[model samples]
Target: MGEVLYRQYRPQTFSEVINQDPIKRTLKNAVEAGNIAHAYLFTGPRGVGKTSLARILAKAANCLKLKGGEPCDACDNCVAIREGRFLDLIEIDAASNTGVDNIREIIEHVKFSPSSGKKKIIVIDEVHMLSKGAFNALLKTLEEPPAHAVFILATTELQKVPATIVSRTQRFDFRRLASSDIVPHLTAIAKKLKYRIADEALILVARASEGSLRDALSLLDQLASFTDGRATLEDAEDILGLPPFGMTQDFFDALITGGEAKSFAHVDSLIDRGFDMAQVISSLLQYLQMVASCKIQGAGQMESGLTPEDASRLREHASSATHEQLRRLLGRFIEAAEQMRYSKIPELPMQLAVMDFFAELQPQPSSTPSRAIPKADTRNIATTQNKRGRPAPQGALLDMREEIVGKWNELLEKMREYNHSLISSLRLASVIACDGETVTISFPYKFHKEAVEQRKNKLVVEAVMEEVYGRAFRLLCLVSAGGLDQKREATAEPRVVEVASSLGRADSLLDEAMKVFGKAEKPT
Candidate 1:
């Protein structure tokens, strides 16, 4: 069997490693100066060279003919470590051996001298997987190890490792490799193997890897095998299950310029073609992000890894859309991507996201002018009759209604302090009318209306209204099928019974009796 690409091309020396210049420089300097610490911790994302760097450090520390802190691969010590046969260089998978006994075994061996080199290097991968007792067993040794012993730990999760263990070591954090770094590296390897791979295909591989060089190389290996050494852009798109860049661009253009109908039509076409909705959304998000960058930083200034024609198209799209619109679309689609994970119907979340973005762009109705309410008697002004025989809110009453609507957001903020769930229901409601005696709120959803009509919730709203408007007012919640624009019918009244204020007042006694025994006629 042929050797895998990742293992075949694993970095064996400090100079061969990709990215991580600071970590490389510091480790090289330490090895050269003979200033190696008793313990070292390497933490980073997977496939980003944590384990490879640990191996390189092991070889460098034990190299028989070391120069400039880099191991001479020709030396006997370096060759054995590279071949995984060095007696002094021990690599432990802490994930498999996680008990106290495993750590005790290491402590037993730590007292012994190096079998073949100057330093006995112990490399523990995924050290965070160790049990609590195992960590405790290892802590004492990490705090005070022998002169010849050296421990190197690597983990993807730094939080799981105890602080005591962390404090006892010199920590080096490895960063994810950039596309710019991975692309040329992959290109060099392809040239070495004499594989004919397209530049666009290489870029796709780099992007799909998402800053993991090992993953990128493994993907390239698969492409090389699949295409028999000649890989094209189409081959990559098929193997990686990514949509074509052109299709993503066209969909984005339809969404921005062709309106909701055209955008949704594009989505339907994609679905018919057997494309995954989540993958399609991901592709759209990547293209949208490129457009956003071009808009902010100009096409000429971007290193977007796209052909000139593609860059120009992105620039044109950027020019056509506003910054705010781009931001809103990005946010909505990101939410759609998250929602797609748990959704039974995969396309539903994306459809909803599209609808919501367009809905937000629709123009809202203009509100009435804000006029100050007069402090004097509003009874006379409220007595004027409208066409429906209801008292018309003329001067002060109309002003008061407009003022309350304007300050609706402030009332919600105050309500949050009392009941957070009520605030959510209230947000879906609109204040249609606010008279001196009653404030009528219309909700499109029946459940939202029911939530606000509960006696406890009603009293809370009325209390906040009194605090904000300087007087108590009854709440009248109506479930309107046609939203806030629908007028209430006298024949079909709301089902919620009216609630009175609990604040100290003479009428409180009568209101309490009405709740238990129903209303009674007053003695004349």
Candidate 2:
């Protein structure tokens, strides 16, 4: 097989490392000022040029007559180091030889001066992997090395490196290359290699690489082989196993508006295609997050790796769901993803999650909107359901010919606990006429007459009557002396009464007194 693209074209000079201009500038100035440290630590994520830059820095330090703070790439020292044949320069992979014995060898070599170059250089990659004993063995040399030796250590994890070693060296942090930076670099490399690749294909590779230039170039190399030197979007997708962007969006829309059955269908199809449940959920979460981003910052500014058409589809789906609804859905998917690990049937939980999401959403009413009750009208106006099953017309008067005395003495007893005065008047009155909506009561005295005329009292009595009979009725307080006299003569013999109870009297009071006094004289 041919040499891989990442290794075949690795950066050879300080200017070639991408997305780390700050670290390069500082190192170059240090070199120009002749202030290079005896030991240096280069730390960052993978494929960010930690080891490669260490080699370059080593060549620059040992280069004869360095200029412009950069190595003279044409010189014997630079070319020998680049070809990995420099006698005095040593590169160790600490991952495989992390024991103290490997470190002891280096410590012993530090006693000798440079044989061919200006300084003997040691580059230990993944230095964090060294055992505690090995680190201890290297500590003395690291603190006080030979004047002709330089140490350059590189690691991806900075936290694992001991503070003692870190405190004794100069540290440089290399940043990951950004997508915008990685894309152009990959595009250029693709063209130089005579491979046909589009900008979108390059972008996909850049995003998948996730800020590592070497990973991007590696992916490009893989794609070139898979596509027979013509890398296209389909080739990238096939190699990476990424689902089409449109399918994920349609899955979301079908879940939201297409009902439970359609959503189940979509999930079945996804399963049939052998898509991993974990990958499906992860992609769904990312897609929902993209929708949420568009909701917050307009759709014109989504940063997802999706194309314009996919972004448009996302915005359209988002329009159907409110922010709260989407938030709830996201939460459900997260919970499902968590439980998916322990689930016997992963699709079962995911399917129920979708069903539950739809089931929880309430459909709006079609016709009447709920409203508060309006204030009631105030009138002495009484309404009744006549024999014809309709409201009686206005100004309907009560007929008084039928005499039906109300049997309410027990009711009167109950009312006395609430108000003794209302029950006292009720004791002296009788219902002489009754309509379904109105009742006429004849009061024996003016006090009773005045008490019943109070609207609050009348309303309370009317409400009680409605509760008792299931009908609304009104009360008429009438004072009558002749009517009481006529009833006394017909029912029983009249009797004389003494005038001992009279204290104060109005004309209505006198009329009310005679009516009740006359009724009391009747023989039962």
Candidate 3:
């Protein structure tokens, strides 16, 4: 049997590395110019061919018959290096042996000239994993090495590599392969292997690989072996273990369309299939982002990363969801995902979180029916007064309170848009005192008061006040000094009445009956 696909398929020459034309061209030119740096730094994400390119550089630098800055693969030095049998070429896994001693050994080895090859080369993979001490030891060799010595350091994480080391080395950044690049590569490989893989199936693998050539190839190999000679879309998905990717967007749509029955069932199906709830939430966030992007820049100009199917679905979902609604749902999914990490009853928290949207879908209560009343029979308005039996001062403060009362419904609407639970709590707050410029409102209990006093809640109150008053109004939440304690305050209060009024005969009879009944109430 041939060697494993990833290894046997590894690029031997610079031209064979995928998605790295610029780096290959520059390195080939440098080799032809005979201006190779003593130390080279290769930085990029995984599977973009950083280390592979480093190996190719090692072979190219050591090849006896190097021409046009490219390795003569038929030469003894190039063949030996390719086979990992060259005495002059050393490949070190810095992640495994990241110590000063490992670096010291390399520095010591730099003194000797090549035994057979034109130059002795060292390739260190994951150089960011090297210990601080090792990095310091390696710096001297990087600063100046023998004319016949070359060093290639590769790292996925560029930030972790020491600045001193980085500054001394010639750097080449490897970019992620575009899907355009990835598709052709996967197709060619599939064809060469005699595997019957569809273009769409290859595209799926490429999309799932996320710009990693090795990952794409490995996934391809896995799918190939799993399906024998043929790789189907279903086989690709089954092996890769990702959701349809459309399911998240579908669930988002179902929730928005008030498809209550479908929403819960969708979650159940996802959970039953062993999809991690956290990952599901993450996918939902990603889906929301795509929808938002599509909304911002219409379907014709989506970001390059999105597939055509993803772009179409995003446009459809974007049409159904308003920006405000999308913002709210995104907030909710984020909250759920955060809570899922610490929740004791995992499903309950998420379920309650989602149920919030369901409640929005419930039919609103109808307005109460009313009968007309005579002018004399209608309730009279009470005069607001101070403790001195004098009318309270009125001006801006009075106008503010009146503004809040008149626009109370609008305020509550805004609160609901921000967060439903906030509006639910705010419903219990009562206007305890108002002098016009500064109005005091109080919640019936401390819990409700604290909830209202939160920074976000305060901001919401400010926004509503500004909307109604056409100016800012400061709201003071207070417990009246003599009227009510912070707790045990009634949300509703009856107006005080003077002693001049008298009850009718029917009311008197009802009072007498209530007195008699109050005395003998312990029948149980």
Q: What is the C-alpha local distance difference test score of each model?
A: 0.77, 0.70, 0.68
**Model 1 clash number:** 0
If both were scored by TM-score, which would come out higher, candidate 1 or candidate 3? 1
Please write out the lDDT profile of model 1 over residues 1-524, one tens digit for every residue. 99999999999999999999999999999999999889999999888999998888888898889999999988999999888899998889999999999999989998999988999999999999999999999999998899999999999999999999999999999998877889999999999999999988998899889899999999999999999999998899888888888888888888788888988888888888888888888888878887898889877635456777777788789999899889878977886787687678988777867755664454432111121122332232223334465655556565756677788778878886776556545655555445567775655546567878989989999999888878878787755432232353332222222222221123433333233223443221
Ranking by lDDT: 1, 2, 3
TM-score for candidate 3:
0.65
Model 2 spans with C-alpha error above 4 angstroms: 255-264, 277-282, 299-308, 317-524
How far off is residue 448 in model 2, in Å?
A: 72
lDDT of 2 at 363: 41
Candidate 1, residue 400: lDDT: 59
Candidate 2 lDDT by residue in tens digits, 465-521: 665556676776654343244545534222222221121222333333334334443
TM-score quality measure for candidate 2: 0.62
Off by over 4 Å in 1: 301-304, 365-524
Q: Give RMSD (Å) of candidate 1 vs. truth.
A: 9.4
- Which scores higher on lDDT, 2 or 3? 2
Candidate RMSDs in order: 9.4, 26.9, 11.9
Name the Cα RMSD for model 3.
11.9
